[model samples]
Target: MRIYLPATVTELGDPDGLVARVVHAVTPALRAALPDEDEEGLEFAAQLLAADDSLDLLGERPDAPLRRVVVAADVPQEAVAPLADDDAAPSAVRLLTAVPWSDVACAHVDEVAAAEDVTAALAGDEDAADRLADRDLLWFDVGELARLAAGHE
Candidate 1:
């Protein structure tokens, strides 16, 4: 169940805080969407967050407002595909808004990469274990992402 959560950067105040908050916000949504999810699913989500640095890929676009939070879980690829599909379940990646905790504006990214990076990161985090596991979600603050994209110039 690889899931990519694209949230308004405002929800994430700083880079370090991004990961945890993202996890908190996305987990419940995912759980609600797939209530039957097990421990393996949770671990997979956590692994994805720890592995990839979403800030690096978005680039340094000054006008870009939101920070993208990427999450991945180990589920059948078929199950995840429809969620990521452009035409189906458009709201699969639940959106959170007007969060006072965030310091940035908007977060955006390529849905495919978000999903791939999250899955790869999670898989690597688990050391490519075969067993299904639950893990924390990955979060990248938009402020930090923008800064990183700007090369801290």
Candidate 2:
């Protein structure tokens, strides 16, 4: 299955060995939520999942205004499993297998311009969340993950 996992540079690795995790998007639940939507719409829903995850990241690190980081990966269906979290978003799932760095194919992050709005959204401003939602996450090649993650590492 191809899942988009919301990640941080620190999770990507700092001192060399950190297994990326699965607060990933694009899961069965998300598909179920919008059965009639096209693939593009589905992908957008996954991005929304990532947006929510980014707020989670803010909760963990109150000072970070960095854009949300989402890494797109391809792992076997068996590798991506459900987590026991009734409170979690429908797209939320667990990654049962370790994601080899090679499995990460691309990334989605906030545009630099979205930083201030993201900060406001992180602070619980609902309107800011809407504004932030309007901003698309920028894409980059997988190789740039290191440099990108390094910012927080």
Candidate 3:
């Protein structure tokens, strides 16, 4: 199954390392919640949810750059389970084990120009957060992750 993992630039230090457990994927609940959306739409919705969660990750690593990162990867279906938290997003899930970097397919990340809004959003600015939600993240191949983490385009 494919999943979207919330992350930060600095967290990509090792392109072949393990990622956190939390991820977002199209679950049955997400399908039920957005019954009218096509598969592509649902997937995009999950990615957006992951992007929002990325903000929380950024808050945890103050030394990390202020940019949202969503790692899209293909993992075994058995590797993930729906999150137990009732308050979690419809697409939220928990990985039963660590996800290896090799499983990652690509990444969607905020461009450098989005850093200002990302900074304010992390500081609890609602408008800044809204602006971030409206922005489109740039796509990067799995091979570019190391360079991205190094603060290069």
The clash count of every prediction, one per candidate, is 20, 1, 0
lDDT of each: 0.36, 0.71, 0.90
Worst 10 residues of 3 by lDDT: 12-21
Q: Which candidate gets the maximum lDDT versus the true structure?
A: 3
Model 3, C-alpha of 39: deviation from truth (Å): 0.3
The residue-level lDDT of candidate 2 at 12 comes to 57
Alpha carbon deviation, residue 117, candidate 3 (Å): 0.5
- Tens digit of lDDT per residue, candidate 1, span 1-153? 333443323323344433322222234444566567585765444334422334323333324432334433223333322223444232243223222224333333332224444344344644422221233233444444555444341
Pick out the ten consecutive residues of candidate 2 with the lowest summed lDDT. 13-22
Candidate 2 structure quality by residue, lDDT tens digits, 1-153 = 677777654555443422545455666777798899878788778767866786677668765546777777777888767878888778878877667777778877877677788778878899988988787788878777677666732
lDDT tens readout by residue for model 3, 32-98: 9999999999999999999999999888888988899999999999999878899999999997877
Candidate 2 Cα errors over 4 Å, as ranges: 13-20, 63-65, 151-153
List the candidate numbers ranked by lDDT, top first: 3, 2, 1
User: Model 1, which residues run further than 4 Å from truth?
Assistant: 1-4, 7-37, 40-96, 100-143
- Candidate 1: deviation at residue 149, Å? 3.6
